[model samples]
Target: MSLVLDNVSYRYPGSTHGLHEVSLDVRAGELVAVIGPSGSGKSTLLKLVSGLTTGHTGRIVFGGQDMSAMPVHQRRMGMVFQNYALFPHLSVLDNVAYGLKLRKVPVAERHRRAQELLGIVGLSGYAQRGIGQLSGGQQQRVALARALAIDPQALLLDEPLSALDASVRGHLRDEIRAIQQRFGATTLLVTHDQEEALVMADRVAMLKDGRLLQIATPRELYEQPASRAVAEFVGLSTILPCTVCAPGRVDLGFAELHAHTGSRPVGTVLHAMVRPEHVRADPAPGSVNRLQGRTGAQRYLGALTRYDFEVPGAGKPFLAESARPAAEAIAIAPEHIRLLDL
Candidate 1:
């Protein structure tokens, strides 16, 4: 089974654009995350997949059938929202069994299936408790159980853990991954949270202005982003302006460094991006691209320290960070220079 979008795009009748020529394929039993800014159309893509909206251009194919032609209910998709969406008056067991009941499963069989799912989600003992009595984490487990009761063809999550407290969200994130693995259901998660996407997805599809920027594994997305927009959006990057001086080498005011800018004509102005952790302080002499900066301040972020430095050679100071929380930054000589591209 597969969920595929072939040049699918949508726009409000009079609006400019929603999604632009987006295409992707999620194989069975894989978890795909769609992440972007608030208005980047992640939610809108979810709606189209779940059959909540139609009449758009291009084709949305699910299990070899066009989804736009199918009714929402017949699509066999399970949706979980940020809110648990459980009925307050209903017991956890009853809430988990709601979808099964609607499908006319036998009462005994429904309870049997619901109990099994609850166990898988680690909420076995709280099945009969009222929704009001369960904590937010427990409520979310109940919601997961309910979604699984029908053995949905595809699981769709819309900002699934956004409502929970930080600690609870962490616990649920692991649980969600476990549940997805256990069920082997194709899943699509819609979220604006970059950490969630990076941690949860088998592959992440980054969006911007309703367009798919890049889709790749977490490692690929972080290490080899396709464009500047992607490089900045996916992680912390220090953008440096540079003039291409020669093949594989560029000059920053401090020194010249080696780089790979891929066949750009000479004299082209370009920017070089390096992850914060890649920027080192106090390098040795003959370093690739060494520049001196002032030790502005250090901020301890639990496990790492963010270093603020003033690059004197460059008119505007640049930022660098490190995992160690030293009172002062490492001393860099000419050898510690990494690259001179900007």
Candidate 2:
């Protein structure tokens, strides 16, 4: 089912920032992730869609009907929370079938449906195990199976695998994505972890101060952010102030280099953003955009090593990623640089 939010705005009576005219759309069978820092309205947005919070301006349409008038129970949304939210005393089968039981499904049929879902989630033989007897990751699986038991039109996940260890979380992230795709279910996931959002979602919606900043594919969000905050949220990018010299170039204090102006005319103040991977270390002598900066920090990431270097126009040190540590002075190519409105 497709979900749409049009000009939705919400605010608690005493709060300063609540959602501010946020709009987003999730196509059928697509997984969209809502990611932001704390109090950015990621969870609140989900709550509004799920009918947990009401009395908001604007319309929420899902499955071709207005959702503002619907209650949570009638929304047909299966929700999996961060803590799993299972009944401690219930067996795995019973937990998965709880929704069916509420609707007065026959005892035998509910068990059959629950067992089938457990198999789909790769827990075929654990039907009799109690929630307390399972590991955290296993509990999460049960939560997912339970949510899908009703064959919901939309699935809402709130950090579904966050309670598990790093390795378990990594594995379950793939599992959840696989299961979601296999079922062709429309899903909305809310998470603070950037990797989860970037890896799992078809499109990522970034929020800031209760406002929707940008919604785009992962590559677009990472490669070309709409604003400085969006750039910082996605990943590390070296931002340096520049004066627009012309349509395709900007002037740094010590040197002028090619940059993307987006047709902003001369004398406009802009910020040049170059990703760490684009920052070339010890380029050929006399290469364009070369600057003498002191390298002070060394960070050994698993796939890439990062070194911080002080650039001329940038007040703060900028990072460069390489196979190994780099020299102090570095040069970033103009083609790899993107100019932002700042």
Q: Count the backbone clashes (under 3 Å) in each candidate.
A: 24, 0
Candidate 2 all-Cα RMSD = 1.4
Per-residue lDDT of model 2, residues 7-45, tens digit only: 999998887778999999999999999998899999889
Q: How would you encode candidate 1's per-residue C-alpha lDDT over 1-342 as one tens digit per residue?
A: 799999999996888758888999999999999988778889889999998988778999988988878888898988998897899988899999999999999999999999999889988898889998988888888888888899998999999898889999988998899899888999999987788889989999999999998999988888777777887788776666776788766666555566774686667677666666666777666555555556777778877788666665655545567776323333332222223223
Name the best candidate (by lDDT): 2
Best by TM-score: 2
> CA lDDT of 11 in candidate 2?
95
| N/CA/C clash count, model 1 | 24
TM-score of each: 0.92, 0.96
lDDT values for all models: 0.81, 0.89
Q: How much does each candidate deviate from the true structure in C-alpha RMSD?
A: 2.9, 1.4
Stretches > 4 Å off in candidate 2: none
